[model samples]
Target: MKRLSFFVLSIVFGTLGLSFVSWSCNKKETNTIVSRELSSKKTYLYEDVPFDSTKVASFFVKYPKLLTFQKSIVALYKNRQYHYAWFDKKGVNEAAEMLYNKMSTVQEEGIQKNFPYKTDLDVIFQNSKTYLSPNLDAELLLSSLYFFYAKNVLTGVDEEATKKIGWYLPRKKLSYVSYLDSIIAKPELLAKDDKVVLGQYYKLKEILKKYRLSEQKGGWNPIRVAPDFKSIKPGDSSQTVSDIRTRLFATNDIASDNKSKVYDTDLVKGVVKYKKRNGFKEDEVITQKHIDEMNVPVGERIKTIIVNMERCRWISEEFLQDSEYIVVNIPSFKLTYVKNNRPEFKCNVVVGAMMTKTVIFSGKMSYIVFSPYWNLPTSIINKDVKPGMKKNKNYLVQHNMEWNNGNVRQKPGPNNSLGRVKFIFPNSNNIYLHDTPSKSLFNEESRAFSHGCIRVGKPKELAYAILKDDKNWPTDKIDAAMNKTVETTYSLKRKIPVIIGYFTAWVDDEGTINFYKDIYERDNRLSSILVEEE
Candidate 1:
């Protein structure tokens, strides 16, 4: 509601904080130029007034920055049968004012770029005499502004650009033409920001405001730690403990600082909370890496949040509609099986190593293979199998692998590379969730040792959870199948959607914002692109 201050058509022109662009128009032109008609009647109904369709092309010729939206504008007016959207017989309608206010203050949406035609737009609403009258420039500019808000605040960077940043999730396509219809029917929809963006984007926006406020107040000083600082356990006492407490308190990680040089129980709670919120192992011991995380500049953290907000824009809304689905956050190395909009189960996972980064995409998991054979891909065969065969006489026999029709395949057993089970999604990347014989790899803090496919730590538990409601395969049957040497496949009656997403920053269900290391070095790349676009 506070943003409505900009909606007043009579507001002083200079107060808008942009230079004005003056224009002269021919009096004979029909909606192709601004008209000073003081007695123009204002009407609330959109269909009551129609503008010349040919003027749409001339409007773009004047404001070239908005030329990109020319086609969308044409389609929008055609959909409305060339009716006036932002104006009525009385004056500028409430919807146009709302859009103008939003466009004026897009910085709150984590967009630093200034609207290209901000000055030109400000001139139309310079005074009630001009804004209240139906002006063709104002009508077309408001329409262009709608799309600007849609792209920056709702849809984010283009789909192809997202792919360049390694985000493979399907982008949500929005038809602003139809969206505008809904907003006009209920102008109150403009007040609900979350209605435009994913709820996650709104949460990040809230945190971004907090971080910006903190930055204004001189964000926390970096905590000092020794180069060889192995760790400070619960009972340890050192000056660094006091520094850590102060740092945590600054970020609301701890209830109070206490300013004590002791790693007391209170500090342990703060440490554990901070660690958990940071995608670290929930531990009271403060390690060097933890201190480094705390020392990260507040500016960098703000950028990370904004970058992830862009990513949230790319996620399809249909992802939230599924009764059941699985989400694997590659940076967090975590897999969560969600059902009915709640997390059913969560487990640690090992993603692809740096050299062989896992592909980010979505797929429908329609089948599960129990006691599956590890069909090694050609890349692995040429790189690992043939080299081993050349070095040792019985390399295949020693590793429980055999040549099957000129291809190497590991037998289905405890030693099998794919361990006991594999969840198949049938993607071109040859990536799937599977149990791994190298189970100990999951114990590592940063688990990214796998060749490509994800290695689930608790494969049997996940299998049972997925088949819990199915009468054909109970927990016992799943266990029996997992233990058997023969490979068995079961088709699921209903496919579960699996989304492999990469997010360096995410707000958890508990409302705690979590930050993870950019394992694939993607955060900066995306952040740079966003700033460049600005």
Candidate 2:
């Protein structure tokens, strides 16, 4: 095969914009793609050996199954000007070896797709003497394998699939070409403890490994359901109590498994801790529902953990580094505020019901409106107001609502649907966080009663935290504004990013894994796609 010149290859693909020439296949050649501007001129040059188009074409022909990654593989090669990225004069480089090992054990990362060229990759690494020369086939195969691993692990199902399943959060876009460049330059980074996926993803993987080991060692048996059992409250004694004890112990909800059949004080404490972590009421009672949750097989729980890991992959680490931000986890029915990489506080929140699910997205919280008027949405007006008006002529008067320019809006006060204050994050979805008069709903184990927007339980505390740094809004002023009958809007000097996300499984900073109900039924939808691919 004739040696291909970098300048010639660039001209053939004029879109690459070639202006200089340099070529070498020697071991000492620099592995770099440089683009610089000369005196009133732009120049592009590759400081490495360029691959022959004929060899790349022949390799694809032999391995036709990997044609799906043809575009990506070509782009990757063009980015480096066909440099031997996966190998040096000695043998396969460290990055290639590390990626090969990761691909071989991709299941540990919750990926189930089998590599298409697994045997070919094994042969190259297993017997390096037979593949001594700079093998284009091995290099291309590694590049293609990396893309496959990244697509399934780093990026979940495509954006369209996620959006179809009601996940509207922005999908993370990563440049594998640039990522490979960095890895090739510093091989040690491949071995670093730093996370390549989202921070939560790494945490979930750690939990997954433990769970899989548990599953392999004969997981816990299902708790027996008694025909006469109504509920197991504190001080109740039965075989079920012993089963609960063992189950809770397996999950570390209880420190010990004494195997005692009596529901003692220690058992009660364990029940409370389990309920709190599982989004149930923190009471010393074990109902059938709680039993059902505990009885969910470890295998199914593993699948749930894997599904949430894919969700973590969608989030960008850049967002987590914000100086100040607000994150509302829909499944957990909780909101957390973070400042300077530390969680300031967390509060209970009420999200939308199944039919009217809150959108999963992110925006900037720029304003806080105190005693905000409730401009009823069209759906609410058509569904509730119009029908109620037909039954009662004075419905508007009774509800403290009035007609404002052909639209009915509730007056700003304690009676307003948006109870005392509202946090506005401008977006097309028209959803925001606000206070509600239905304080009792917050006490419910499953608080998904809102129309679409989030109903915060501690609106006053949230407002105080948001405006604590600003001298213009003191505690007295904030209280006064919230109590006023008229609507008052305050613009925040620095906008905080608000991310409304859905995560059914999460690991807290304390390394405790908490699981929540998939309120919107999104897990099965995502899991189905993964299963189909598998």
Question: TM-score, each model?
Answer: 0.88, 0.88
Off by over 4 Å in 1: 1-44, 124-126, 191-196, 226-228, 390-393
Pick out the ten consecutive residues of candidate 1 with the lowest summed lDDT.
17-26
What digit string (tens of lDDT, one per residue) describes model 1 on residues 1-534?
A: 111111110111111100000000000111111112222442235566688898889888889989889889999888778888888767877787787787787887789987788887787777757666678888898889888887888788887898887666666755677777666656666656443455667667788999999999999898887767798998888889999999999888899978999999888888988887677778777788899999998999999989988887776655534657777888878887766555567788888877778888888899999998777778778888899999997999999888899988888898887889989887777788988778787777788777678889899999988998899998989989998978999999999888788877776544567787788998889888898898
Error of 1 at 497 (Å): 0.7
lDDT of 2 by residue, 295-410 (tens): 99999999999998888776654453465677788887888676555556568788888777888888889999998888876666888889999999999999998888888888
TM-score of 1: 0.88
Local lDDT at 429 for model 2: 76
CA lDDT scores, all candidates in order: 0.75, 0.76
Q: Candidate 2 — which pairs collide?
A: none
Candidate 2 has a TM-score of 0.88
**For model 1, what is the C-alpha lDDT against the true structure?**
0.75
Error of 1 at 237 (Å): 3.1
